[model samples]
Target chain A: MVGIVVVSHSERAAEGISEIAAEMAGDTRIEPVGGDGQGGIGTVPDAIEAAIDAAAGGDEGGDAGDLDPVVVLVDLGSAVMNADVAVELSDAEATIADAPVLEGAVNAAVAATDPSATVESVREQAEAARDVDKL
Target chain B: MTEDGAAAVAAVAAVAERIEAERDHLTELDSAIGDADHGGNMARGWAAAAEAARDLDDPDTGTVAKTVGKTLMSEVGGASGPLFGGSLVFAAAELDGGVDAETAVAFAETYLEKVEDRGDARVGDQTMVDALTPAVHTFKKSIETDDLPPIEALAKAVDAAERGVAFTVPIRARKGRASYLGWRSVGHQDPGATSTLFILEELLAVAADRLGVDAPETDATSPTIPDEDPDEGASEDD
Candidate 1:
C-alpha cells in the first residue's frame, strides 16, 4: 500500500483534510503535517519531514512492506515549497502531487489504500483531481 | 577566518532586525499583489532564524546557515519560506568556513540555483529571483574584479538587489499569488523582491560592521528605472 501525506498552511486544515481523506484510506497511512510549530499560519518543513518519516514507516523499522512508498498532497503556495524541502530532507521515497488539496487528498487516499497501489499510481490519481468538476 | 560561525550568526541577527523594521512596508507591498502576509511571515521567519542561530553551540558557518535555513523552513509559510529556506540550506552547504568574499559568492550561487530549481522562476518572473539573480551576478562580478574589496563587492550585490526590487515594480508578476492578478500586479513592488533586497542589505551591513569597513548606504543613489512598456518580455519576438 502506498502512503499519503497532506501538507497545509493551517493546522486545522491539514488535520481536517487528513481526517476526511482517511475515510477512503483503508490500510494506507495518511499523515497530516501543517502550520508553524507555534500554531500559526505557515507550513513547517520539519513537521512535514516527520510526517513523511511516519508515513513511510521509518519510525517503526518494520518489515520492508511497512516502509510504503509515499505521495504528498500540498495546499497553496508555501505548502508546496515546504513539502519539497521536507521531501529533500527526508530519506523516504516521496513525490509531491500538483493538484487541489482537499480533492487530491481524498482521491489519493482512495488510490493509495488500494492493495495494488504504487507511488506513481497514487500520485497520478491525486493529480487527476485537477480535472474533477466541482460545478 | 578563524571565527567559526559568529559572523554568520550576526549577519542573520541583522537580517532579523531589518525584517522586523520593514515588516509593515512589506505587508503593504503584498497587499497590492498578494495575500498581505509577506511582512508578517518574513518577520516571524527571520526572528525564528535569529533565535535558532542563538541556540547553536559553538557553530560553524555551515551550522549557522543550516540552522537559519531550517528555521525559515519551519517558521515562514507560503512560497517565500520554502524558496528562501531551500536557498539557505544549499548556501550553507557551500560555505567553507566563516563568511568572506569567497564564501559569500559560493553561498549566492548555490542559493540562487536552489531557489530557481525549487520555484522554476526565471530572471523576469517578478519573484525573489528577480532580486537574487542580479544580486548574485553583481556579487560574483565585483569579487572577480579584484579591485573591489569584500565589503565593496557585498555593497554592489546589495545595490543590485535593490535595483532588482525596483525592476519588479514595472513588470507584471509571472509567478506565485501575484501572477493571478495579471496586469494588476504591475506598478507594485514585489514583496518577495523587497524582502530579498532587505536580506542582502542587512548581510552587507553586518559584514561591513564586523570588518570595520565603511559600507555605502543603500539609499545613497537610486538605480535607473527602465522604460515603462510593461509587456516588453511578452512581446519581444514572434
Candidate 2:
C-alpha cells in the first residue's frame, strides 16, 4: 500500500494535519512527524526519517513490508529541508512533495487510497495542491 | 593523505572547540540579521558530533564524518541543520575510500554542491555558499592544477573562504532567514558565511598539525604555484 507522511514545524500542526488527512486516508498509513524533539518549534531529520519508516509499514500491527514506497508532504523552510534529508537517509523508498502542507496532505491521503496509487502518483497529487485557489 | 578514524575525530574535536569558543560571536552576527540561534545551535551540534565521532569503533574517516553529520542534523535545530550537517552527511560518501588530493577535491566539491542544493543559494546570495564555493574551488585548483601539497592547498582554501566571508558583509541578503530583512540586511556579516570560514580555518589548522608541517601563509588574491612534485597524492578525477 502507498503511504503518506506529513511533516510540519510544530508537533501539534503535524498531528492536526494528520487528523484532517486521516478523514480521507482510508486504510492507508499516514504518519505525522515534527518538532525539535523538545519543547521547541522546529523539525528534525531523525524525526522525519522515523515517520517515513512508520508510514512505510503495513497497518497497525501487521508485518512491516520492506522498502514500501512512501510519499511525504512538508511545510516551509527547514521542514522541507529536513524531509529531503530524511528521504536521503531513509532505507524505504520515499519522496518529498513540494507542496503546501495541509492541502497536500489531504490530497496525498486521498490519492494514496486508490488501488493504482504509486509513490510518484501520490506525490503528483500532493504537488497538484500548489495551484489550489481559494478564490 | 588518508585520514584514519582517529585523525578525523581529532579534526572534529578541534572544530568543535573553535565553534564553542566563537559561539557568542556567531550569535552576534546572526542577531543583526537572523534569529540569533546560530551560535547555540552550532556549538551544541558540534559538541555532540565530536562525542559521536569518538564513540565509533575503529571507523574510517568517512564513518567519522557521517557520524558527526548525523549528530549535527539532529542537534542543530534550524535550516543550518540540513544546510551544514545534512549536506556533510550526503557528502561523506566521497571520503569513504579515504582522503587524498583527488578524493579531498571530490569531497569538497560534493559538500559544496549539497550545501548549495539544500539552501538553493548561490555565491552572491550572502549565505554559506558564498564561503563554500570559493573554498572548494580554491582547494580543487590548488591541488589539481597548481600541484600544491594538501596542507598548503587547505591553507589557500581557508584564505579564499575568509575572503568570501568578507564579501558577505556588504551584500544584501538573497537567501535564508536574513532575506526577510530586505535592504536592511546589507552591512551585517552573514553568520553562515562566517561560520563556514571558521570551520574551514579549523580544518586547515588541524590538517597542518596532522601533516607535521608549518601552517602555510596564503592569500586568496595570490596563490603560490610551487615547483612540480611527483609524489603528491593525485588521483584521476573520475
Candidate 3:
C-alpha cells in the first residue's frame, strides 16, 4: 500500500493531520513529523526524512529495500522546503503533493486504500483537492 | 587543510560573527513582515556551522561549504534552513577541486539557482533572489567579460548586492512569509536580501584579508539586478 506523510510547522499539527487522515487510511501507513527539534514551531529536514522512512516501512537511515512508495503533504513556507530537502535526502520513493496539507492528506489516505494506488495516482488524487470548493 | 578550504572556513566564521552582531537588526527587519526568528535562527545556525567547519578533519573548500550548508539545514529554522543552507549544500559540489575565480563564479551561480529552485521566487519577488541575482551576475561579468582580478570581482559583487538589498525596499513581496502581508510588505527591507549582502560583504572582507591586499573600491549605482527570473520560473503564488 502507498504511504502518507504529513508535515507541518507544529508537532501537534502534523500529528493531528495524520490522525484525521488515518480515519481513511485502512492498511496504509501514515506518519507525522514537525517542529524545530526544540519545542518551538518550525520544520526540520531530518525529522521529515525520518517520517518518510517510517511511512515507507523502513527504519531511519536503513536500507530502503523494504519500503513502500510514500507521498508527503505539507503546509506552507518552510514545511514545503524542508519536505523537499527530506525527499532529496531519503532513499524512499517519495514525492511531495502540491496541495493543501490537510485536505490532500485525507484525499491521499482514502486513495491509498486501493490496491492499484501508486505514488503518482495518490499524488494526483491529493492534488485534485486543490479545486475542491466548499461554500 | 587546503588553502581554499581554510579561507572558505574563515569566511564562514566571519559571517557567523557578523550575523551574531546583526542579530537584533535582522530580527527587527523580520518582525515587520515575517516571523521574528530570522535573526536568532541565522545567528545560531551560522555559529554552529562555523564551529562544525572548524572541527572538520582535513577539510577542503567543498567540504567546508557542504558542512556549513548541512549545519544550516538542520539548525536554521523556517524557510531559511533550505533557502540558505540546503542551497549551499547543493552548490558546494562546484567547489570540489577547490576555489578559484572560475569556480567561485560557478559556486555563486549554482547557489543562486538552487535558492531560486527551492523558493520558487524570482528577482522581483522581493526575496534573496533580488540580492543574489545581481551579485552573482556582477561577479561573473567582472571575472569573465571585464577580466578583472578575483578580489576586484568579489568587491564588485558585494557592491552589487548592497544595491540589490536597497532595491528590496519599496517593492511588494511576491514570495516567502512576507508575501502574506500583501501591499504592506512594501517599504520594509527584506531580511533575507539584507543577510545576503552582509554575507557577501564578509566574503569580500575575508578574501581581501587573506590575499594580503586592501579591499578594492566598487561602485553601486541604481539597481542593476534584473526585473525577472532569467528562466521565468516564478510561479504565481501571489
Candidate 4:
C-alpha cells in the first residue's frame, strides 16, 4: 500500500520508470507521480507539492488513512530543495531518500509497490547499487 | 521498533546524516559534466526523508521506506530522484518485514533489474549501473559463500561498488545527460557513480554501528537543530 512518486526533470523518464515498476509489481498498489521539470518549472515547491499530493492519492480526495505513506523521488538540485520544503509544508506523511537517477529509479519503483517495503530496505538497495565489481 | 524494523530505521537515519555531510562534494562532481546539482538534490531529498522519519513517534520499516521514497520522488527533481527513490522502494519490498542475507540479496537483484529496465542502460553503460550491478552480484555471491556475516557482506559490496565507480573513468558514457558529451565524459568520475559510492559507504557505516563493530564519528561541523517539543506539532492538519 506504499505509494511512490517519481519526480524528474523529464516526464518521460518518470513515466518510463513507473511503467516498468508497475509491470514488475503486478497487483501491488504502486502509484507513480511524475513531475516534469519543464524548463526549470519542476523545481518550484508548489509544483513539487502538487506532484506529491497527486502521488499520495490526495488529488482524488482519498482519505488520508487510505493514503499510504508517500515516497518522493527526484532528479536534480533545486528540485531536491523545493521537494524538501514541499514535504515540510504538506500535511501528508512522507520521506525522502537519495537514489542515483540512472539506476535507483527502477529499484525504488519496484520497492514502492511491496506491501512490506520499508525505508531501510529501499536505502539498502540504493546503497547496494554502488558496488560495480560484483556485477 | 518491531523485531524486523529496528535495523532498517537505524539504517535510514545513519545514511541520511552521511548524505547530508557529503552533499557539497556530490554537487561539485555533477557540475563538471552535468547539471551540477547532484549534491543539492541528494541533500534535499535526504533532509526531507529524515524529517519525515523523525516525525513518526514509532515507525516501522515499511513506513520509513515509503516516507523516504515519496520525499525523494517529490522533493528532488531530475533523473536521480526517481532512480534513487525506486531503489529504496525495491529494497523495502524485498525485506517484506525481514532483514537477512537472502532478503538483502533479493533486494539487490530486484534493484539491478529495475535500473536496467528503466534507464535503458546495461552493465557497461557508464552509468550508476556500473556500480550497482557489481554490488548486487557480489552480495548474492557472499550470501552463497556463508563465509561472512551481513555486515561483512555489505562491506564487500561497498568495495565492489567503489571499484565499479572507478571503472567508469575510462568508459565513454553511453547514457543519461553525460552521454551527450561522448568522449568528454571520460576521465571525470560520473556523478551518479560517486553518489552511489557515498550511499554504500553510509550503509556500511550504519551496519557496522548496529553490529557494534565501530561507531561513526560525530560530525563536528554540522549546525545543531534544537528539537521542538513534539507537543507543539501534534495537531493533525486533516
DockQ of each: 0.72, 0.76, 0.78, 0.07
User: Which residue runs of candidate 3 sit more than 4 Å off their true CA positions?
Assistant: A60-62, B220-238
Going through the candidates in the order shown, the clash numbers are 2, 0, 0, 54
Native contacts matched by each model: 1.00, 0.77, 0.97, 0.10
TM-score of each: 0.86, 0.91, 0.93, 0.61
Order the numbered candidates by DockQ, best leading: 3, 2, 1, 4
Model 3 over residues B122-211: C-alpha lDDT tens digits?
A: 988999999999899999998898898889888888888888899999899999889989999999999999999999999999999998
Q: Judge candidate 3 at residue A59 and give its lDDT.
A: 59
Query: For candidate 4, lDDT tens digit of each residue in B1-238?
Result: 5744566567667777887888888888788778788888888888888787777767676667767776776666666765677556655577665667777778778877866655667877788899998777777776676556777667767777877898888888888778889889888778887778887888788778667796332222111211235444455443
The TM-score obtained by model 2 is 0.91
Off by over 4 Å in 4: A1-40, A43-135, B214-238
- Judged by DockQ cut-offs, the docking class of candidate 2 is medium
Better of 1 and 3 by TM-score: 3
Steric clash pairs (candidate 2):
none
* Model 4 whole-model lDDT (C-alpha atoms): 0.67
For candidate 1, write residues A1-135 as lDDT tens digits.
677899988889989999999898887888988877776777778889899989998877776455767999998777787888888888788999999989999999989867788999999999999999977
How many backbone collisions does model 4 have?
54
Worst 10 residues of 2 chain A by lDDT: A58-67
TM-score of chain A of each: 0.94, 0.92, 0.95, 0.72
Model 2 lDDT tens row, B69-179 = 889999998999998899898889999888788888998999999998988889999999998998899889989989988888888888888888999989999998899
